[model samples]
Target: MKVQQLQNAVEAFDFDINSDEHIPELGRLIADKQVVFVKQKLTEERHYDILDSWGSPGMSPVIAGIGLGKLKGLHWNAVRNTTARIGKLIDPRHRSRMQSVTFQKDHKGRALGIFTNGKLGWHSDQPSFESAQRVVGLASVEASEGSQTTFLSTAECYDNLNCEDRSQVDELMCVNRWDMISKNVFDHFAGELIEEQHAIMRYNGCPLDGLTAPLKGQTASGVPGIHFPGSLFGYFLGMSVDESKKYIKHIWSLMDKPEYIYTHNWKDGEVCYMDQAITLHARPTSVDEGDMRRMWRCSGYLDKLYPGQGPMTMKINVEGEEITWDELFKRVDEVRKAEYNRTKWSKIFHKMP
Candidate 1:
């Protein structure tokens, strides 16, 4: 398999999983390019094999209970399942993770699932999770015309800033929060089931006051890059929400330049991997309703780098009291059970017709 550089941001090659050097070389290329693409589609076994080669696959905090049994992995099945069924199938314990990405619409033109038909704002996958996957892989099962995935190099974004701007943000920390109860569509259909069912859990709750690292940090290979979390960012420590917005906008202005971005129009049978820590990716609004687009995503932890570490501590507020994360989740679960018992028959009755 010949390896070639694509747009300076991604390295592309046809994968050969059996070659002794391929796996190591793949690792090296990912470190250098921040993203890599394989032109060939992989079988299910090969797909999992490639991911295992990196590290233990990270459990998705969004799609909860559907597991690969002893295989210990998860799959996002947007193309094959209906929106309501997908919503009903998700394990409430993992409801906070972003739901499926799709532009599918019903005959009436209403959005059919968790994601809207509009463009997804820029983000790295689940940056707020304490066990956030260090590497993410997506394999295309189908492709849509006029739909493209864009990527920005945070390290490149950081380097382009003036020295003073760099110094100002280098020591700062961003307080990231995603109120699963507020931002997600699960509750819209299921009615706070996740929150009520104690599914309002995250690996780590919000960052503690005054605890933060640079918005720019060193990559696994010791390369400095921006770690902007985009929409997941709530506010920067030591700055008011307004101040944080202005600061973030200023940083985005520098990073948004054309030369810093790479856009890929995916084709069927292609797979892409990205170093989630140092990059931000987005999808433009896909307007073609007749087109079918599908991709399978999997995540893996950074456990190899930090051995024997357990789940990070989390915190949350319950009725204005700051409580332990576990305590809060217990309350949510209790609420869910109560709500489920109250509505179970009604839900079944609604479907009976």
Candidate 2:
């Protein structure tokens, strides 16, 4: 979607996106610019308010075309390692590895589960980290001849239920260690996961069994959000051993309802980004990973976050010695300046003593 055409689409929708004003550009900016941006403009003056009502400056518009707009296709995969080369660099903070590299077949079938495939257990992303959200990007290289990227917004999910389900989740937490959840089968494991002894280290993802991220959430207009722990299955809030299992069955039964799902039919080059906070997504699989199904799926959080608290720093091991905070900060600044343009974090490697 060309930049000018994006504005035109909004105008065509009769939302009057001011052309000569100070509204921040609707989509991404840098090396990820897009040729077109698709958005549902608002007739109400509270568009930002609607977005704000969702909480934080994290709303993603479906965008097509190339350039920065293409970043939307990136979803939330802003990590720099395509080959999983940095698998060695992750530092496990617990007895279990905090993330999952994911087996191509045994688990989610390399990311394909065309409709007839049974329901995916509900869960959120990045619940293991100290952070509250993760950026998730999706680009439809192809779709099930008729399937879409189906999702259940946590807000919508929690909102649709009774005040009782909401109350049960008021003060619960789940654990995110891999060993505590699933078995480690991938031989090509990240050094950190191995060392940390994690069972399945995917963020906020719960084991198909039970066990989930500890109490994690956010506040929107004073309404609180409590996610069902992935590890513990549907038991996170108040469901019991049998009840939790039943709860899973119940939510799964509701999968076919249109009000609870937003299935995305991917455009060849278009990308979609979403705030993990408001959305829970799943793909009905297609072929298998090695077949035509192999779409490069890479996931990572920001190598450095500019959290408003300002200039946070950490010392990391590089080439056998710790890189000082001063050097790390300088490197982070350089990275932020060159954001979205640079590939490979080898520049940080060269700074090794």
Best by lDDT: 1
Give the residue spans of candidate 2 off by over 4 A: 1-123, 130-132, 141-147, 176-216, 219-226, 231-257, 293-353
Query: Candidate 2's residue-wise lDDT over 1-353, tens digit each?
Result: 22432210111122334341222333221102211223332222232222222223321111101112322323224322221222222232210111122222334222111111222333445443223333343333433234345555444455565666555445444333344343332222222222222212331232122223334344222223444334333343343456655654554453335665555554443344443433455554333234332121222222222233111122232222445534533443343335434433555667778
lDDT of 1 by residue, 188-264 (tens): 22232222112212322222222233476444455677777565466776688889889888888888877878888
RMSD of 1: 8.2
Q: Provide the TM-score for each candidate, comma-separated.
A: 0.66, 0.43
TM-score of 1: 0.66
Tell me how far the alpha carbon of residue 346 in candidate 2 is from the true structure, in angstroms, after superposition. 36
Give residue 145's error in model 2 in angstroms: 6.8
